[model samples]
Target: MSENTQNAPRPIDIKLHQASRLLEIKFDNNTECMLSCEFLRVYSPSAEVRGHGHGQEVLQVGKEDVNISAILPVGNYAVKLVFTDGHDTGLYSWDYLYDLARNYESLWIEYLGKLSAAGHTRKNLS
Candidate 1:
């Protein structure tokens, strides 16, 4: 195998648990992560969320109850997640997904901090 191929992380399985609002992904490198739908929605890589450049990320609010409506494959390298709120632009690459999984805790903490800084409180879905 080429060096790039050997080092690149790839998903072996991806499952969306609607009831739990979690997306479970298992990678070929033996890493397994369960990411919340809200997290994914808030951290969407689309321009609408990420913006066109640095320091332009739009703070996502009211996504505590958001869920994945669909997962569409993007070639062999990524998947496009269609969110219930009508967001379907981000193409989540394998590397990006792996990074999200591995850094979930810290990233979530950062997100919470941002929310708090913006004076936004999270409301749980009833």
Candidate 2:
């Protein structure tokens, strides 16, 4: 494998906190991050979320109460997240998850800014 692939971070464990709607990921390098379900939903890597090309992105709303229903392994490289709202296309690789953890604060702020700009609010999904 390539050096970049060889150095990719691996998840050691994943814990779901249903009540708090948080997914805690522990990495092999001893780093851990607690990601909100809403964040994951909004930042989904699926085609529906990302769209077909640059600037074609679609904003996701009303996912504040979204929760991961299941996590299916896609191989040694990635895992597919099945969300409560029936979105299951995104295959989150280890590198992508690590990047999400590293950039959570900025990404979340950006998401909120976009939502505000679009006059959208997080509604109850339950």
Candidate 3:
């Protein structure tokens, strides 16, 4: 857990904008990452989304139209996401969120490239 914590980054502020499908996050430890809702949805930490155990990630599909239904706080370091698709299990920690935010550009581009390579279409997250 300590190693995981150490690898995770820390964010000072996190904002979820449903209107533009954007999750804007700022880290006091010196970084900022503006991530898209679709990006977060596809990269969700839930077992349903990620699969059980390590190296078993299941590629998410049709998340192009997914949205966050609600954001619930979890203790001092986590946030629970209730997706519009009714998924509400993943507990996204502040550190995890920070990492996601910090790596958004690279990850987003990767996601786009992967989608394109797979001939998949992200039809706007509603």
* Highest-TM-score candidate: 1
> What lDDT would each prediction earn against the true structure?
0.90, 0.87, 0.76
Q: Provide the clashing-pair count of each candidate structure.
A: 0, 0, 0
Which scores higher on TM-score, 1 or 3?
A: 1
Of the pair 1 and 2, which is ahead by TM-score?
1
How does candidate 2 score on lDDT?
Answer: 0.87
C-alpha root-mean-square deviation, candidate 2: 3.3
lDDT of 1 by residue, 26-121 (tens): 999899999999999988889999999889999999999889999999999889999999999988888788888888999999999999999999
The model with the greater lDDT, 1 or 3, is: 1
- Tens-digit lDDT string for candidate 3 (62-87): 87767787888888778898888887
Please give the TM-score that candidate 1 achieves against the real structure.
0.93
lDDT of model 2, residue 33: 100
Give the per-residue lDDT of model 2 (tens digit) for 1-126: 122465877999988898888999999999899999889888888889989888999999888888998989888878898899999998888888888888899999999999999998766554
Residue-level lDDT for 58 in candidate 2:
97
Reference-based lDDT, residue 52, model 1: 99
Q: Which one wins on lDDT?
A: 1
Model 2 error, position 18 (Å): 1.3
